[model samples]
Target: MGALTPEVMVRSLSQVLSFILAIALVLALLEGYVYLLFFRRPRALLGAIFTRTVQSAIAALMLLLFLRFLDRMGLIADLVAALGLAPLLTLPERVWAAWSALSPMPWRLLLPFFLILALELLIYFAGEPRPSRLGLAYVLILPALIGISFLIIIPFLFEVRLAFSNMAMYTAQNPEFGLRYGIENFIKVFTGPVAKDATFFEVFGRTVLWTAINVFFHVTGGLILALLLNRPMRLRGLYRTILILPWAVPSTITAMAWRNEFDFRYGLFNILLRNVQQFFTDLAAQAQSLPLIYDLLAWLSQAIHPVPWRQDPTWAFISVVMTNVWLGIPFMMVVILGGLQSISQEYYEAAEIDGASKWQQFRHITLPLLRPVLVPATILGTVWTFNRFEVIYLVTQGGPQEKTDILVSSLYKAIFQFYRYGFSAAFALVIFFILLLWSIFYLRITKGLRGVYE
Candidate 1:
């Protein structure tokens, strides 16, 4: 788009104001109609209905006229043009195209809406058993429900449809959708190279390893910090604030900063390593008669070489993992700290009185009490880390021959880099199902929601 000239800015502002006013008017009319139907309880229902029908017809006619006036004045077209959008296929036009494409299967198109309407009717009649209470609850949550339907449910349904199609860059506009296409897509995902020589199973295995290593460190590091913070200390608040900085910063920024720090030369890690190696060398020189010092210096010289973090596959994987672990630990520390504080001190006191040692007290009292908080936190942590894309993308971009590519990053590359829409959709579904099954199993094993239900 061109630079925002004053004329364009003023025209855009006017269009926004006009759109807001139109929506406000429509909402006001809806509120009045709902008040009459559910709150006011008009004595003559048929008369109220007739009045509302006539009012709605007039309101719709006026809205159409208003839109026509804007079109005649070229305000709408100007806004579209200023935004650098195609005038031929606006958002509404695209929606209309999608709707037309589904005209061949009218039942399929209307099934979700019909199901939602039926669910609402069932809830209205069968839930609460009070009209006012049901109406109030539905009115309060209707906006959220509508937002989810439009933003999440509709897009998910579209993805599922795409998964069943033979869509790619060439046939994105018109792709054949069927069971065979879906099967082929899924089979291709497993049987073909996902990204330049990286097989599906290979990427999946690497993803699992990445998640396990990161989560392990996150839990251990966070637990240690939380435990220390739980004790009375002079600089407790300051330490907590400093420790949480990694989590407080945006992940993208942190990932980029860490990526820079992993550079082979002039990077923080290599600089520190070089300094330590030099210090050891100087010490060994002074203590030349000590054979152990010479052996230690030899080990340091071998081990403290500047690491090729992004060049070597193993170190590239390690670099991303280290970045993610640092980024993830603070969150877990805060969560575990909260869980730790919520445990009653009375349990620990009683355990001590019973002659229980510190380890016994922790194993029996602390672990059991913190189960409620830790279970949910771990589940959430697993899900977030599993789908984490920013650190992997920013730090390594699944580089070093795609050795560090996780399922989500691979799926992203498939769609955006390779333009294999159908294949990526199928791959996404596979990832979703894997997480879903793992969550269900973990919940069953941990009985995480038992306390909530109780």
Candidate 2:
């Protein structure tokens, strides 16, 4: 390629600036729309301020694009120094005039100053007319951040506004929702499913039970496995590899695999069942003279029967709990193994010198020392298992009957299958409170909070 000409660079800079100005104009228009339509500000100043800031930001972007297009990174810093710091430049006085006149809002000065500073940073990073290799890739990043921040801020504000109102789809469609503000949604969440005639207390109780049962089994099973593996035995490595496999595998896959294994017929369990024909043939052969064996067969025939493990209530509950408990152990085992290794061997040695039994040593020394690890893990496991839907859903589809359904799946069914989104949202809010209250109660009870630096 021939050496770059001044005319080519100027043309590129013009195109970049034009593109930047177009985007700025669009953003300023959006600011006015959001302020007037969504926020409904009593005064127009907020819209004007937002629009002006956005326009400035756009201009900064244009400058950087020009520098980057011209491949002149150093030129940008030099220009900023020359323009920003030149003697008797009158730049500060011009900037002060822009700030004062840009918005007649109460925050006019503060808003414009921050906006101008933000624009300056955007230009410095973008490297518009001259490109730094580093700055070229990042030229558009600052404006993008600003755009994303608007997305979050606007939605969050609207949601908060909605929280204080009785708005719905019909009302949200209009610029001014006809519905009035009230505390009814909050009250409704506490009272129960208003349409179903069930009280909120009932659902809350169900959630509490659900959380407790899952945590109980998870902790018990995990502790048992961890204890077993900690002991020295033959084939220890192989045993650990197999035992840890359940947690290493995805819970969704494991749940489904176990589900198929529990099928009533044509499953592994049923296929392994002893054929009655063999027993009958043996009985016939022995019947000619073996009275004692005949008597034993008669006795044994009355004792055992095939269990409908998933079909029946007692065993069905057991099956879900067992599967979740099994799924949880490997994670706990891995975490607990670290905790166990950290225990000072000196404690065990002292206990042994004092003639303490292994059980006594564990109860006295290990349990207390393990509390730090166990307490946090227990809390996390409880919360996660309470909301664990995939494992249980994939396992039973919350079925045989609805006996195994927990709050999360039940809420999902209510929303998706029944199309009661309003009710489900209310229910979700209730769940949030229940968890919050539980966490607070836990802290009060245990005095263990997050990031306790000491």
Leading candidate by lDDT: 1
Which candidate ranks first by TM-score, i.e. highest? 1
RMSD per candidate (Å) reads 10.3, 16.1
lDDT of 2: 0.62
Tens digit of per-residue lDDT, candidate 1, span 181-219: 999999998999896779999999998898889888998
Each model's lDDT comes to 0.78, 0.62
Q: How many residue pairs clash in each candidate at the backbone level? A: 0, 15
Tell me the deviation in Å of residue 228 in model 2.
Answer: 2.5
Per-prediction TM-score:
0.77, 0.58
Which regions of candidate 2 deviate over 4 angstroms? 1-207, 231-234, 268-304, 309-313, 450-454
- Model 2 worst lDDT window (10 residues): 33-42
Predicted candidate 2 versus true structure: per-residue lDDT over 1-454, tens digit per residue: 8678999999999889977865785555434322222322222455446645655655565445444432222222345565663432334456657877777854653464456556444433332233245443333454565577556644444444444444444443332221333255556656645324335565446556766777887677777777777766898789778878998897778888888766767545444433453465467567747788776675554443445767785566566776787787778877776688788889999999999999999999989998988988988888898788786678776665555666777676656665544445556666766789888987876787546855
